[model samples]
Target: MQDEPILKVVNLKKQYGPGCQWCSNGHESIFEKNRCLRCGTVYACNDLSFELYPGEILGVVGESGSGKSTMMKCLYFDEEVTSGAAYIGTYDDGETNVFQQSSQQKRHIRNTILGMVYQNPVLGLKMDFSSIGNIAEKMIAAGDRHVERMENRSKELLTHVHIPLARIKDEPKKFSGGMQQRVQIAKALSNQPPILLLDEVTTGLDLSVQASVLDLIKTIQQKFGISMIVVSHDLAVIRMLADRTIVMLDGKIIEQGLTDQILENPQHAYTQQLVYSLI
Candidate 1:
């Protein structure tokens, strides 16, 4: 049996405030440090733990401000886990403690070993560059790569994500939301990473489009044998896609079981409340 998890997170935490340059609201001062979410103050993700096995589609569901996105970022090496440990052991001849890497080292590992699908499609693609060019830039950034290799790989990944071969030339704004999401998926797959972090991939889409995208994700998961972590707020989404489910609340896991087990017989009051509301 496999001993190590394809992805493992333990006691992770993250806090944000105005000083983040990359965040949409650049934290120029103490007052503007974090994004203007409800409280307009710094937000933190406290202790959380979970695991994803190869070819597994694991769903994480919770209320707003539940740290789902932050945890996803920790897994993807974007917002580094401020405390605790994240163990990512890849079967493709790789093993690393994600929290231990420096920012530069983590950046190098991102596209090659960890491909992330963000909640906001805009976050995954570059704005000024052409869609294809943006992808090539990511490939180059993955390992200081050559342009040609990045281009060819970009085309291949676009094809894999079911993007029209020709659409690669257009800028991202020209595409529909669902279509732009496809481009984001293509970009995430560009480096052939073994693990994929999907943060609310279906948010804001109509149910029909949401189903299609989820189907595509399921198909790719089967084809590539990649382990995936899907974070979402909808119970139905979790019910439909997850092999196993971890119900989280207040920054800690409350219950975990086969998807059916939790849905049919929830052990925790918080899990029951969510399940009841769904029914």
Candidate 2:
């Protein structure tokens, strides 16, 4: 791992609804889990902060409504953050807070510097577009105008993700869940981004298919040396992929460390429950 982080996030916060004085004044007493009982405001992500190192897979494990997915959405610009700062080592010398960038700048960053694969393939791929077309679309967004180059790159990525060349021209809508997810993975990698955000990418797949996708992800990371943040509720997934793990609960990171360390010696009660459940 590199000494400096490839991506750094500081005090990232995302919430829904306006906060009441009780919740806004740093009083946890007025909140129920991550929601403010008094004002009905939901703190979907509360002061999340983490770093992603080059060539490392960082696992974020949390149950439903725990804000892990919300955090990914905020990082990928799918949802606006209420407040926080993020710096990318390759963007502007890692000095600018990406959240404060203009929409155009953010779009540029999304298209070129970062890639995201949504848990639902529909959210990531244009289902009706040919699988290759979906990949070309992302390349085009990044200002690649050479049609031949796009096609070649798309084919290369698709093949790398284990999408059969014979089916490259087919629309994702006609694919099985596993195939669609593989196409989504190919599309996300079309830009050759330094950072990849995978939000529960294998959630609904069968066990065998999920294993295939996981192995593909590991292979991609090793081959491309891409830094990735993989969010999943499954500890088994985390163990298989992440070099480091961050355990989240109720919108906060309750524990984090080397994946093996966290698994073997879970300090938090919630993390212990998660670890023991894998037994």
Candidate 3:
């Protein structure tokens, strides 16, 4: 384990507005007029803190509505953090003012310092662009504006993802689901980021495909020395990848421990239920 952390999320909170699917606010009893933005009611994920060390894999797990996705949004700074600080490095640098940063600053951070793999590969890719172009887009954002750098980086990334160099010119529509996701992985790594966030990266794939993608992720994490946060409901995936596991419920962390410890001796009742079902 590295002594320094690559990403630190501290006391983080996210709330969605009324009409949102994930809202955790009070039942529609009081009927306040000015609800939060987006969903329209408060989808509160309050006061969560977690860290990811270099070359370490931290898994976030829970049932639906457990705030796993909410927490991820906060980490990536997608939804404005209503409060608290999420530091990308030097966990104690006291840079708690993410909202105050300009849009350019946020873009630079998201582009150069972090890589994220979404649950859906297609939604994250450009339907009009070829595979190589999609990966090169990341290079452009990260300041590798020259065409040669973009081309070289794209080819290298596709190679890293085990995609044939010939397929790099093809549209995503031409690839299998697993191959498309591997492209997503390649694009995420285009900037050579030290931190990667995988949110349900294997969702909708068959067991064999899931295993292959999992293996690819493990290989990349080892090769790059990047810190990773794996968020998934798949317990088997968590067991295989996570150095430590955090289990959430109703927008709060209910349990955390070594993956083995929690799997073998779950403390919280809900955690026990999760474990038994895995049996």
Highest TM-score among the candidates is held by which one?
A: 2
lDDT ranking from best candidate downward: 2, 3, 1
lDDT for 276 in candidate 3 is 98
| Tens digit of per-residue lDDT, candidate 2, span 1-279 | 998999999999998989989998869888889999988999889898899999999999989999999999898898999999999999999999999999999999999999999999999999889999999999999999999999999889888888889999999999999999999989888888999999999998999999999999999999999999999999999999999999999999999999999999999999999999998
| Residue lDDT tens for model 1, 225-266 | 888888998999999888999887755677898999999999
lDDT of each: 0.77, 0.94, 0.80
| TM agreement with the true structure for every prediction | 0.84, 0.99, 0.88
Off by over 4 Å in 2: none
TM-score-superior candidate, 1 or 3: 3
Off by over 4 Å in 1: 15-43, 91-96, 144-148
- lDDT leader: 2
For candidate 3, write residues 135-204 as lDDT tens digits: 9888887778789878988998888888999888998888888998999999989888888889998989
lDDT of 1 at 231: 90
Candidate 2 CA-lDDT value: 0.94
RMSD of 1: 6.7
